[model samples]
Target: MNDSFKKIAKTIKKSNSIALFTHISPDMDALGSSMSLYYAIKSLGKKVSIFVKDNITETQATLVDTNVFEKDCNQSEYDLFISTDTPSQKRLGDYAKIFIAGQRKIVLDHHLNDDLKGDLNFVDTSYSSCSEISYQVIKELKVKITPQIASYVFMGLSSDTNAFTNSNTNASSFKTAYELTLADADITNINELLYKTHTTKEIDLKKFLYNNYHLENGICFCLVTCNDLKKLNATKADCDFFSSELINMQGANFAFSIIESTPSFYEISLRSKHGYNVRDVAEKFGGGGHICAAGAKLKYESIEKLKDTLVDTIKYSGE
Candidate 1:
């Protein structure tokens, strides 16, 4: 086993109780990886629990059953805490305290920019998802990855890669999927849970963007005002994948979506064409992700000023 993988396996082997966690506002990738890791450890006859900063949207809740293990934030007595898909400690949200206070911890993540603060860290920026990392760790430990594990990890990779369309996917990802399929993973059922369950509200939100969003300088941008969100009856999760659609727009160099999370706060999402790096843009505004996909949050007094600032930044940077 590799040094990093050994470190994690050793930690798991020594611990009696394991508490698994993911980033705030858990997406499929984050949730899948955490849950899959939880199950893997539990199959080893260890006590395990999974916790999230907030409840996942109903759409995601239906897809993955978090009830498989006990769920809560009280980790004062837990033996090991595992943080998945979180690039930094700050992104842990309310659970930051538990992560800091926990005596033993491990972090499995795929973000390019990670300020990992863990006793054992397994980070691979090149990998498509943290679920992929979970797979590797389990394989190195010589544990059997069952069909249920495969389905969850596949959901993680498929969701993060937009079903393998993103640039992060590689030959290893395909081989991993194939190996998992051999283990009895039902690809059709996984896809049905992951992608085929969009709600009418989400569809209406997408239709609104299709009709009103605009593109400039080969960069497509859209704004979801608080009023628009209210009208559409959509939550932040509903619009998570909204910006990815723009990246594929013919001749577009970058795609962006800004959502008014509060009157004074805006969350921005950016996606890029082949050569561009969205992380640079996100870093400018104190956010970060991969080269092609990234995000940032801005607090402004006026929406028009925020819009102008974003447009000016993108236009002048020539990104």
Candidate 2:
């Protein structure tokens, strides 16, 4: 609809081979948007490859064709590189090199981080999800939005908006969802897969969260140590939505879930309600995300120290 979108369409039209990428620790939005674009580009007879450096969560994996992603790819092979849902190039992990190697690069994102790294950038923070922007881009390319593509787009929209329950959901998100449905996207299956189904291990993790959690200064928080994960035979994927679950507490203004991925490396997920901006809290620890939902990773020392620091950070930021 604008000059940039037209340029992006032209770029994709001119390219023969395209590589699609999302940030590391791929979520439903990242995977969904990337896969949706992949299908759209492939339909144009362009050689397309999607790369993911990390294992996708089982919940997100169910939404699309996972076989299209190659964990290992030659960075120098692609003609055009497109990054979706990634705020910055550093978040690409090992796949950043592909972006650097490509003859041209484009970025489609919804985060406030506007440090544009792509040759052609489309960063719209007003949109609910990058998938929403991607849907528009795919349409601009004049590619027929197939049922599979619509399903992938719908998964991204649903996941990032928490099935349209989060603060980011708006009129545009609903309109996009309706369009995807008209294209034959399976909204029923997408909702059931993302929200309704949970494995025994996942259920155990939820139980553990309820049994062991702390509430202070309007922050409901929990820590899952590597030992705890091992005892429960659960992976980080099993605790995927724990932070969101924490924010569901009766009086919680915000929530945090800190997971020790290794002996000294910890990953944190934060969610906020009541107009709290968790992004500022996440940025304090070298992480970035949306206003209401964000994440960070830090080195573990002692649980007490980490908890104290985070409590102070969230309290200070929220005020």
**What lDDT does each candidate get?**
0.80, 0.85
Q: How high is each candidate's TM-score? A: 0.93, 0.96
Off-target runs (Cα >4 Å) in candidate 1 are 1-3, 68-71, 196-198
What tens-digit string does per-residue lDDT give for candidate 1 at 72-176? 667766889898898977678778788878998888888964565787787778788888898887776566788888888888888888888778879888888
lDDT of model number 1: 0.80
Overlapping backbone residue pairs in candidate 2 total 0
Cα deviation in Å at residue 60, candidate 1? 1.6
Q: What TM-score does candidate 1 reach?
A: 0.93
Find the 10 residues in a row with the least total lDDT in model 1.
Answer: 66-75
